[model samples]
Target: MRLRLSALATRPWLVALLIGLAAQALFAFHLDRPGGIMFDEVHYVPAAKALIELSGPRNIEHPLLGKELIALGMDLLGDNPFGWRLVPSLAGTATVLGVFTFLMVLMRGRMRVAVTGAALAMLNQSLFVQARTAMLDIFLGAFLLWGLVFLLWAMRGTRGQVLWRWCVGAALLGLATAVKWAAAPYIALVALAFVAIRLRDARRAHRPLAAALLSGDQPHWPGLPSLAGLALLGAISISVYFATFTPTFFYLTGATDGLSGLLHLQREMYAAQVQVLPHHNYQSDWWSWPLILRPIWFFYAWDHGAQRGVLLIGNPVIMWGGLVAVLVAYAVSFRGRALRPLALALLWTFSVAIYAIIPKSLGFYYYYHLSAIFLCLVLPVTFDHFDRTRDRGWEEWYVALALVCFGYFYPILSAAPLDGPMAFAHWTWFPGWR
Candidate 1:
């Protein structure tokens, strides 16, 4: 029994499975409650149903993959609340597993760090809210994380396996872009990072740079992809993104039957997305996102004879503490103390920085979802750093505090029954939150 238990404990797949199941259960619980469309469901759910009937178009500013998946759920389960939300819940669960896989690879198979990161990701308030609602960000997040996961896997794969791994990573990222254009920056980041690393490796190995570029060899990390491989990966991603639009060609109202139509649709999407719009009450700046300056209230009303609300906010402990963790990680990296944490910090920064360059004039707190999820990586890395420095209890205390905050905010985060009409006051610690 002891040996069997030990074996079970060491199996990362089993552990990841458990984590994914727990996340799904949480996202699915009371998912059918509120008994009606909440927030953007009014946009995507109808859009999804319309796609199924091929009657008209809706929500044209975004890509089709997310709505297609939502439509699949509704078609299979009946066009009800459960059907509308089930896919996003599953995507949220996939995001948890992606976090686990990503950290596992980044940390060199340290199960503890991976599991801790996944747990924090599962508890992130934004993830919880987006997972329960029919939204595109969670889909974007799941694909984005898995894309990075595959890229990390490519770094460690054998020579014959690396190319295929890169392709898979690029494909997933392409799917992410198909879900939303926000994912496009990540692809650029990946391509640029690969080019830089490949060039660095060639210089270090004393190889002729031009020769190495054509041959696709790396001295430091053997099997690292070459420029040619990167191009192929980009092509694969673009193909995937284009393929997602195939269904749109058949849509009765917004059909795009050829390449010219596809180009026209792209122009329409760009016009709709970037056009300046009236300010939203919950609109926030990118800089203030990590600070949790504002949160979007997806739902607030009397349900089952009590007040309930759903607030798209990050867990305070994780958000605030993760910010500190990123700073500390950067400091340590500058002093030559660590390299991996530094990479996480850079990725976290880039995720938020993409929003700054995008042409969109309006932003919401929920746009910070990617940044909040990346904090899961920073948190575990910080815990590992503390453990190495003889600060053994920080991880435990961090997890405990995170769980406590999650419970305190559970009522608002999950649209659970509140104490009274003013129950929101309990969680609204700051005036801005109101």
Candidate 2:
């Protein structure tokens, strides 16, 4: 009865929207805390400031769209900690809304579980920490999630709406890639998903693979407009990508020789990203991230009477528990051949691919940020299944556990100064974390 009431919110969309705003509020509220640049803020905040002052290229390894967005925030909010980080915090909140909307769209009539997923995303330690800082990853990730949602919506649209939705999705991704090339893989994954969905639909309808390729299958997937739609989507995506570089195009003209300057600049950025580097203090392999075994220390402070440390890491409750949930889902999902399970598997696989393939040596702990959110998304599936089947306990317990951890870790994550050395030491449960 309580479960049904929970689902009976008068307008679930509004509830999700409010949750998004609340999430944003939570991230935005502490902008001025533990004052000064933290972590990658040292790099991005300066670049953002440079863009505002029209200073020359800085943080040249990445494109300037993200910095430009940050500059806009600084322009309005003032050039302090709050101002530099303002847009990233808001983008993080908007990401929560996007995730909620996507889950609602993905799972028909399953508002409760969708909300559960978004809420988990809100609290995941790594995601929450990443969102709070002035970093490119959060901005890149927020737009990627939104674009994927819109792309899925396009797949569900009529011919008339399909083109428009697809174009919009492409445009968002174009901007996302401009923020950080890390989003390039997401764009590729979506194109790949379009083909996979069409193929899967044809096979489900018992059409011969060869014949379908030759002439297309009967009763096409409601989720997919057509195979030719793939071509159209790709073309629009490329055009949108080029469109995002307009600022870069002109910015380059001033900073370099000509159109050749643009090409040369891109090559330099690419070279920097792939260049090998020696071990650093915060560098941790992707394998350790899932276990919460390694974390980046963003800042440490000692005042006349206060001491505080800002550690970048995941919440053990979600990281460890979510890992178990995914293993359970993987084992059970294949046994039934269900669409929900299959979709879950594909989405999980994509996020994993993004992290797993990254070089283990140069990997920063934050590289695992998206994977942590993916696990959070996967973490709830097992619990949602239990609720639907009257096989319960996991959902309630998991939520309880997550809430407890959220408060327990709030001090360090928010950059609150510690009461004493002992208090700070207590938060580090593992030697590697210290």
TM-score of each: 0.95, 0.91
lDDT by residue for model 1 (37-90), tens:
889899999989998998766888998899999999899888988899899999
- lDDT by residue (56-167, candidate 2, tens digit) is 7788888878888888889998888788888888888877777777777666546666677787888877777877788888888788878877887766666566667777
Q: Residue 287 in candidate 1 has what lDDT?
A: 90
Alpha-carbon RMSD of each model: 2.2, 2.8
**Model 1 misplacement above 4 A:** 1-9, 219-225, 389-391
User: Global CA lDDT of candidate 2, please?
Assistant: 0.74
Backbone clashes counted, model 1: 0
At residue 140, what lDDT does model 2 achieve?
A: 80
